[model samples]
Target: MPLPRLARGASGRPAAAPRVRLPREIKVLLAAAFVIALGYGLVAPVLPQFAASFDVGVAAASVIVSVFAFTRLIFAPTSGSLTARLGERKVYVSGVLIVALSTGACAFAQNYWQLLLYRGLGGIGSTMFTVSAMALLVRLAPPDGRGRVSSAYAGTFLMGGILGPVAGGLLAGWGLRVPFLVYAAALVVAAAVVAVMLREPRNAAGGDGTAASPPMTVREALADGTYRASLVSAFANGWATFGVRMSLIPLFAGAVLLAGPSTAGLALAVFAVGNAAALTFSGRLADTLGRKPMVITGLVVTGLALGAVGFTDNVPLFVVLSVVAGFGSGLLNPSQQAAVADVVGNERNGGKVLATFQMATDAGAILGPVLAGALADRLSYGWAFAATGAILLVSALVWLAFGRETLIREPQLQQRPDGTA
Candidate 1:
């Protein structure tokens, strides 16, 4: 039997859809992310230099390193709530708008505090777009294809991370403020693409079935064990990935590997590439294998690999470790997202839970640079990086010790004759 298109109209009822065929909207969904990444990346390498240009000390420049994360962490939980009240499409678009305006504002800033304000505003946009985009991905996808769907979204960001540095370096060579201009332009392009190409998926709206209502607050989602575990896993992953990679890795490359800034950048890019390549496979793997195993394994191996990266002094060793760490990170996204989807399935509460998860991720992102940089200053980059890895290892073990898989072939978990809550 033939089925309806993946994106049905305004009605919330998802019509029966056919077996796996990638929807057109997938490209639309991933489009804004590329623009966002490019703009952020263009200025990323030299943000400290920009602050320093204003006569600020290294300590003040650190805000350029951390404000983005701080703002995101604060706003992530709110994304879902806002989206549920609105809709995924509006939230996603609004986010792009915010980033565009914020970047434009940054380009004109002449002082340290002005730049800080702009960067913080951009974080709000990032959170708004991410939470809604993710919720939409969950809703649009068929149950069987959830992993790949998320893998595609995750992969987009990964690819963006790859391109950001190469682009950032070249643009930074041109001018301190050119990157911001480039970011604004790229965002315009992304906004256009999403608007023209993407069509909203109606079925994934709100919570549960048409009869059910989405939770009004983030507090509601936290009360559930399954949701809570997913948040913890995401936070652990983000802390290890974002915190260590941006803050401590470059130092490790220069000090231990005897490399330069470019080498350090390449090492970071390798991590993104590794995760992106893995996404090509992990999506299908998640469908066949399920989500928790992938999340647990990703957490464990990433930690171990970070420890190895810290321990090694050789350039070749760092490269290999970057690839492995990225693969581990690649595993965490789809599995954790799928778990969120399992609980959020057929529920409009997608916005609420997605927001909560983003907060966890944001918290990690916020903590990563500041905390890692602090540790590096006090102790060593190796210690700063390794500690995050160790944290992941412990977090993974906790999940495996007590957490159970959220989704198994739906048939196996179907309710039996007995009434058990």
Candidate 2:
């Protein structure tokens, strides 16, 4: 069915505000995201801990986390269409409520299956919230400023990476369920912020300035050739960046540096630092350099970093390589998202595109680890890194061979601090 032709996006605007201007609307969005991130992070580290309580091993406990990713993979396609139909204001709020209730239920979970059920439910709601947020950023932020604005949104996850572990560790010590309750409260606060602070009455109208209607479903989203390519690219990127960085690198560290898991953790932290640092500038560069430029650069460099990791026996050398690889990761996300918005066009479709992309994320994570795991069991950790690196390189080649630059309506011009146009 056709979506309602309201002139506005689900964000309740024709498009988001300019990237150059940090408005109250954007702040509310970011603030809510921060709260959500905090709540979510507060429990993340303890997933394994929580599951172990039921006498489940590490692998089964991991399912609690993986189940969420898998569920999100399923929901991603529909999330965009739902946003188009219902509008972000409604979906975002309801998603938070769902997360709250689901997480709260886990507190009462008497068994591993119950915990898995609740976590999976929360995962569904998470897709709704995440997709809605990304969709709104695409709809609300102007074309030229997309890279920059998207950077801010991406930064939230990175920030959460840093803080969530610490918070989760502390809260879990208090009791596993205690963090779940705290997370619930945090979502409520985030929901209230959105309800009260973020409003643009004009955008309530869909394409024709009428009532918002549902946009295309995942079925329609998958039909698009360009969207499919983006998903494939996302899979390649995720598999290489995450699967290896988390699982394979430690083995390499152990082999080369004679260090343990702690060293591998440090290596991962270094990669994140590189990602965070690059994000500070990469977004602006994407605006100036074009989205495709960053995309290609990110892919090529990340692949090279993975390749570099294979050659290194020196710990410091690998650290540098890890940083480079992380920077590559930082560059990949925003540019790809901007490209999705470009191909799909702004409005409710942004939500759907993100959902599809997230599926690729899950696929990469699931498959990457399996592939890496197999390589490790059979050959060596080195082979695993090399294989992922090769895939990264292949991703770049594919993009260069077939990937097209997303059409930007405007050339983002840099302005002098003096305000010279």
Candidate 3:
């Protein structure tokens, strides 16, 4: 679907306010995200346990999780280059296809090593899709519209995350490998949808028309205070939400809460519900409200909620805390993404910037599981959660000290009477 053109003012700037109606390209992308996340969520509850079916310890099982992120972290730079050269649509579809094949292969793996290899290979594809998708979205959205766009994307994934786990828990009863097959099928379908439905919303020729400027270099982006702060925020978000939430929460459920697989899935689903609920509103608010305050508030909330989760033994309390943490995550993520978009602007290629941003998150994800798993093994789950919470607190402190607002404004910084200009 084509997006309506933005009206221009007498001064030749966009005069229209951001609209709530999303463009077709973004809508289709959100659908694809939902399906992909749905499939992954199905597998999330079972992946570690399935790996441990080979008689490995907790740390080794975590290797299966970390290996996927390790590959994504290493390959993200290359994937960004590919997205830049080939355009996002082609790279995005190809990436999904690779992951589909890899996930299908994973279903039949007879040993831990085989599972590790297949999962790790899938990570390369994951990076390709992720970087491309983010680049595409950032490119297409108007400056004022980025927050809502980011939220819509994240919201769709959260919706899938909510539904996939319950279904996965039910399917897990059939076999540990069943969810992998299902996930592979889902990815294939998502790939087909992307291939058929995805188009550059603005230009038929495939450019968004805004990326005409020379692409920003990674070093340049890092120099910006806002982008630097976003990296820290992304790292903490990944460490807690992507890494430990998926890997350790289930283990904690079993060991502490005395819940079974179904309950663990329920906890994950509840968390997604909380995230989804907040995301719909958070994006629009971020667009109007400034990025820094929302992000700072979210970090504090997530940190406190995550820390609380470690101490709760009641299943209801755990689920409630997870939901609260997810809400905080939903609040933080869209704003962080919008801040990056704000810095990169519409004139520069976002591939490298998006890739670097992704790598920061992947760095935390790659390390979190291994470290948390070791910590859990040596000390306790509470300590592991505490460590993850501490990371968020530190991230908040970093933002408070060094972060600058990235939302585009018409006025320059006000000069003070003392000496500052």
Candidate 3 has its poorest 10 consecutive residues by lDDT at: 1-10
RMSD of each: 8.0, 6.7, 7.7
Clashing pairs in 3: none
List runs of model 3 lying over 4 Å from the truth: 1-18, 45-62, 108-112, 169-182, 200-211, 251-266, 312-317, 372-383, 409-421
Which numbered prediction scores highest in TM-score against the true structure? 2
Per-residue lDDT of 255 in model 2: 76
**Candidate 2 residue 340 C-alpha distance from true site, Å:** 1.4
lDDT of 1 by residue, 196-228 (tens): 787655543423555545444556666656677
lDDT of 3 by residue, 209-290 (tens): 5534556688898888878998998999889998889889998999999999888878877777878888988887777666
- For model 1, the local distance difference test gives 0.76
Position 354, candidate 1: lDDT: 83
Candidate 1 vs 3: which has more lDDT: 3
Q: TM-score ranking from best to worst?
A: 2, 1, 3
Residues forming the 10-long window of minimal summed lDDT in candidate 2:
1-10
State each model's CA lDDT, in order.
0.76, 0.77, 0.85
- Over the full model, what C-alpha lDDT does candidate 2 score relative to the true structure? 0.77
